[model samples]
Target: MKISRTIHMTNSGRKHKTNKIKSIYNNMLAEFKRGEIGYSTIAILGQSCLGSIAVILLLMNDMPTMIKMVQLFLVTVFCMAFNGAVLAQLKSKITFDLLIATILLSACVIVTNLV
Candidate 1:
């Protein structure tokens, strides 16, 4: 009975943590959508520059062709999706999410290429 109680407590704790994280994520998305968490022009430019450098590094890396192609495809897709969101005037939250994804994906690619 004690073991079962401990397990139940652990499960409930996990659920609580999950709920907290989800709440935070939802609140942040709402703020972005409402333009409360603004992305300034400079921030956008900086993200773009980082993404471009990452792409350049990826292209110039000596990795296998197949890997390069896959990475390039990922980057292209993320970038295109972000651009599409902007062109279509989608919710700011969606655009912001895509922009963040592009930046994060680029950073990962850049780090992998550098290493």
Candidate 2:
């Protein structure tokens, strides 16, 4: 009788599944660090306006309360991440303060919804 060995491959196989995603995220982070002031400003402002509009629309829509809350949380997280990236790029004191204020306001809204 001869013994044979067979290797089974999983979904990830030999490479980590998240390597591509991790590389992309790292590249984006590096770009943000080396981005210009004007570019960072434009991104921050544009994203702020868009996020605000999205939150407003979600609030006014006929969605369930839980769904609206989840949407709000996701929107707030995106807004904060954008602001953080801009702040990291520009290293501006004003951007830092704005980020803090945005977080506080989001927390207040969430609290109100929960209560």
Alpha-carbon TM-score of each model against the true structure? 0.66, 0.48
Which stretches in model 2 have alpha-carbon errors above 4 Å?
A: 1-35, 90-115
- Tell me how far the alpha carbon of residue 69 in candidate 2 is from the true structure, in angstroms, after superposition: 0.4
lDDT of all the models against the reference? 0.76, 0.65
After TM-score superposition, the amount by which residue 87's alpha carbon in candidate 1 deviates from its true location, in angstroms, is 1.6
In model 2, which range of ten residues has the least summed lDDT?
A: 90-99
lDDT (tens digit, per residue) of candidate 1 on 1-115: 3445343334644534458777887886776666633443444566678778888999998888998999989987887787677768777777878887988998999899999
lDDT of 2 by residue, 13-48 (tens): 475566887777567556655555765677677667
Q: How big is the positional error of residue 81 in model 2, measured in Å on the Cα after superposition?
A: 0.8
Off by over 4 Å in 1: 1-24, 36-44
